[model samples]
Target: MLSLICFQSLITLSQIWLLAVMSILWIIWKSRNDVKFNNFVISVQRAIGTVMAWIREGGLLIKAPMGNSILDVQILHSLHLKGIPRRSTKVIPVFWHPPIADWIKVNTDGLSKGNPSIAASGGGLRNYRGFVKGFFGLRLSIQTAFFVELKGVILEVSFAWEKGWHSL
Candidate 1:
């Protein structure tokens, strides 16, 4: 199946085909697990429906070319499937307001893989004109979200103090 899709000219079409293949594989694996552990019986039609739905949803996350490619349409047609219509995407414009003169604005964020997993904190210092003054990122050992948040602020504050920017 992969060999057939790999020869496609468009990389985007290849990606869509790959996603469909992965979705089918995932549904099969999940059905096998369900039968093994939960003794759940999934019919053929139900499994196909699940794969179709998964492929449809997963395809949406991937950005295709500007318009539909001929290969894309042909592949779907051959499978007796219809491509999911692209959803209307909404664009929201965001503007950043600079701080007052002689003041430094600090922004920080922390993220962890799991709640108590490996974590990292990062932040940046912006001047009144919104130009970046300094930035820092630290990779910490196992830590919680809350701890990382506070650590980010502490690190940024210490950075600002060291830079002699007291007015934040």
Candidate 2:
């Protein structure tokens, strides 16, 4: 149960870090006058949509017809037993309550740590407002963070559309 809390805290840091990178990326986007950010954003968004659709079509969920939700739980348990980041148990909390139709609330975050080069971002979507939804925490290279963040936004928007909610 507490592992979930640690996971959330890491995601928060990942969000802050991603924002900083996005600000820097703004400069990169500005350097190229012939190109627009929409190109990158759009490509990633399309990719995410396709991947999610694939998940649904292929039944990729744990104990759920669409996907294997328990895979993440198992991975987390493995990491915990292996003492990965053995000290991430201390993380500050942030309160959030997102609105969704048909009882959905999500909490997302980004996480990056120096040692062992871990960078991940994920969240949970819940029906009961207080329950956890889905989570993803991955060890990443610095360059991958950009890709991951982009996918994160893409996944977010795509999920909203799939749920017939307004994300715009």
After the best TM-score superposition of candidate 2, give how far the Cα of residue 20 lies from its true spot, in angstroms: 44
On residues 24-102, what C-alpha lDDT tens digit does candidate 1 reach at each position? 8888899999999999989999988887777666666655442254656676565554555445568899987889999
Q: TM-score for every candidate vs. truth?
A: 0.48, 0.30
- For this target, which candidate reaches the highest lDDT against the unseen true structure? 1
Prediction 2 TM-score vs. true:
0.30
Candidate 1 similarity to native, TM-score: 0.48
- Model 1 misses residue 51 by how many Å? 22
lDDT of 1 at 61: 68
User: Which sections of candidate 2 miss by over 4 Å?
Assistant: 1-103, 114-118, 144-150, 163-168
lDDT of each structure? 0.79, 0.46
What lDDT score goes with residue 49 in model 1? 88
Model 2 worst lDDT run, 10 consecutive residues: 59-68
